[model samples]
Target: MNAPYIHGRRRTFSASAAVDTQNAVITSIKTDDGATWSDMGRVLGKSEDRAAAYANTASPIDLPTFLAGCHEWGGRFADPLLALVGGRWADAGAICTGDEAAALTIANLLPAIIAIEADNLTEPHELLPHEVLIRRVHALTAIWLEMIATEKGRAR
Candidate 1:
């Protein structure tokens, strides 16, 4: 369960709030003078009314909350990648030979994943217009999920 935050008293992370903020940021990006909610909704796969509400009722997405979501999302996907690496290690030990080649292949890929994960989590929505940033994030997340599924398949 997410923790309740009382700023002056106790502070806790709220994933829901983060998502809400993300919704708002997306709205803000879509509703700029140059963009319309309909266009934004089309890009984000949301309905026009939902997009407008997000824009109209949007609140600032706190940096910490946004960063936390990024970390959580990345971690959810990274688990399988690490497991695949572990399985490769196990295979090496079982076969009385090191699959250092396979291991090395996975190792080489880790840096790119780490870098991408960092960017996905830490990059501000403000860096790009609303539609571009949101779409990029969605694409990155899809890639991350694919990696996890592939890794898990390899592990089995």
Candidate 2:
């Protein structure tokens, strides 16, 4: 296993992808103040797609869990401006609280990003829904800004 890196909220996150048939992709997160590591569970199997190809796989991450977490965090009320850009109201703050939230947001964006890539590869003229794209971008931006703020706070 590789060394874990600090993700946020003083948590260390790490993952090990399968290299052989006997291995499985594993992910775990540990809090700086805690002695025990919390397992985030397996991300992939050796028999499954290669770890390097994860980005190209459809539904590479857990979408339902991520979406549910976002909803649970009250993302719908986090940002009023989202209504203007995407014709929908959502609270971006709901998922910008910490490193885990940031990870979730990134995971949430992956499938769409992959789809965009697939579209580019297959049908360059395919038009994605502008509002959907706007909402995702807005959410990602909000999370990014929050992370920066958190990091700045740490600096002081």
Candidate 3:
């Protein structure tokens, strides 16, 4: 689901989803100017099999909450690619195989993330957008990838 958000602007967007438990039906809602949300009603019932397929395919990916939040915020900030890389790094760190280099790389990223958060608090929103955070995240991801590669090399 994707929507545009402009501060102090009147815009309308719709969100819809269909589910098949006992029946196939769609539920939808729309918000005008970020206010006065109203139901858009369900339409286009599909075959139960089709709905089931959709449900099966739509299962959420398992990820840590903090990493997921970072990805969501990255999308809102219009830098999903970078946020995704950061999320991958977080995932690698979580499942790290007790390698010293991987541990050190993950530790190094903590201060960078903290510094980015600190800078965000002081700068205007426009001045310190997600791009800046993404750059740091990308750097962290590179370090993480290098550490993983090094660990793999040592294994062989």
Candidate 4:
């Protein structure tokens, strides 16, 4: 299989047609609302050309530093990054503490995993495989980590 990042780029291209460049960590979004480049440029503290260039091909060395800016793009970068790590946005989703998240993740995952093993799918992907119950544990792990971090006041 290809590297995780290669798959990430593939999914990014598949999910958001605007990320038309390889190795691109971000994309210039142009929805019906407006052109996002200018605002994105401003947010990243760079000119439009500079922002576009960074979005097009953020080198691996610069990616870590640049990602701090990308996070400000809201879900534009978040969603793709989550998907890269086998996840999706859950901000407007469930609200639960680490304990609750554990119970919820287990309560939700057990049956589906059993069903999958038994070759019985109760429902569709609900949309994407990433949205399936099989991924609940992974997402929940991340959630719980953050929840713990927050509880300990170590969140960044």
**Model 4, stretches more than 4 Å misplaced?**
1-25, 28-33, 58-71, 74-100, 117-131, 138-156
> If ranked by lDDT, best first, what sequence of candidates would result?
4, 1, 2, 3
lDDT of each: 0.47, 0.39, 0.37, 0.53
Q: How many residue pairs clash in each candidate?
A: 0, 4, 0, 0
- Local lDDT at 27 for model 1: 46
Residue 55, candidate 3: Cα error in Å is 64
Worst 10 residues of 1 by lDDT: 83-92
- Compared with the true structure, what per-residue lDDT tens digits does model 3 show for residues 7-103? 3224332222211211111111112212111111111133334423333454322234224333433332223223232322333246744334544
Model 4 pairs in collision: none
lDDT (tens digit, per residue) of candidate 1 on 1-156: 422233222334455554454564554444443678676555445566765654465443344433432343333322322233332113223564432444454555555556656746745443343444344445455657867976786799
Which numbered prediction scores highest in TM-score against the true structure? 4
Residue pairs in steric clash, candidate 1? none
User: Pairs clashing in candidate 2?
Assistant: 75-91, 76-91, 78-91, 79-91
Q: Residue by residue across 19-133, what tens digits does model 4's lDDT show?
A: 3332354453434326576765676666777666656654321454345554565555556555554554555557734434567767876765565557544555532453555
Local error of candidate 3 at residue 56 (angstroms)? 65
Provide the lDDT at 46 for model 4: 68
By TM-score, how accurate is candidate 2? 0.24
- Give stretches of model 1 more than 4 Å off: 1-12, 31-33, 57-156
By the lDDT metric, which is better: model 3 or model 4?
A: 4
